[model samples]
Target: MADQEPIALLLLQKCAQVEAAAGLVTAVRALHGPSRTAPIVLLTEAEAKTDPKSSSVDAAIPIHCPADHAARELERWRPVSLEPTRRIAGILGPGPIAGMIERLGVRLEAAMGMLAQERIDQGEAHRLAGLCGTLGFAQAHAAWLDLSLGEATSLAEARRTTRLTLAAIARGL
Candidate 1:
């Protein structure tokens, strides 16, 4: 725990998906700065409480999450519209303009089990639920814009899902 070790992203994928995103964004921003160096471990409610130590983890970002709770908080740190989308896409890929959107979906699918089992607390569950909603909404929107990527039934359905997902996120917020 003390010795500096090579960083390897351990996608615990518990429910802190939004925090993971933020951690990535923070890392990227830090690289741009003069003095910056830290390790990030995006943990869900269960992971952190179970094992608070990691040889590879320098710090644990215990995001109060159970799914998309970060999205509500994320709104404050959003990439200022165009820039954020571009930044996220850059990290995600050339898959689509919604590269981040889809990654978010993947994140949601991974966390669903944890959320459903209620492996976390009430507050964390609510937060994670919000993140799930946000990611799901983003995924629906992106899938519609480009069904070639798959997962979308129809543009109308996509819109409906996005609306619902957005509403879910709003509710959590």
Candidate 2:
């Protein structure tokens, strides 16, 4: 149900009227509570020059921009999923905990495959490391850090770390 919450507010600006868009953004923020986490994105005409940060909008993208660029902007505004920490579990109930663990295991397996192929990027490695820590897989977190920081010396070492991390996940501790 958390995913059902509003991800963002998208306002369409016709004819390059940034002032109107800004006003709408202000109204939206006021109505939704100024502290709302959902970002407001303005879609403007190609020639419209809007500075989103100055107007309280999270992002402004031209309607004519490339699809990938638009998608990237939307993704930038997407809310990050809450980690399955004890506090979160208490609030959201225990049902999500098992699901989170399963998801983390799947992600770790994928990361290990990427590591084997030398295709894992530092950003992904760092993210996985954080997830491991959140899930209480300390050794896996350390191994992820080693991979992320280039501290692991060889492919064999990386494989070993991956196996160890998998084992930790299997142990469910």
Best by lDDT: 2
Error of 2 at 77 (Å): 41
Candidate 2 residues lying further than 4 Å off, grouped into runs, are: 1-93, 152-158, 168-173
Tens-digit lDDT track of model 2 for 84-164: 344556776667766877788678667756754566588877888787777655555777777788765533344444444
| lDDT, model 2 | 0.57
Backbone clash total for model 1 is 8
Per-residue lDDT value at 34 in model 2: 18
Candidate lDDT scores, in order, read: 0.36, 0.57
Question: Where is model 2 poorest over a 10-residue stretch in terms of lDDT?
Answer: 1-10
**Per-model TM values vs. the true structure:** 0.20, 0.41
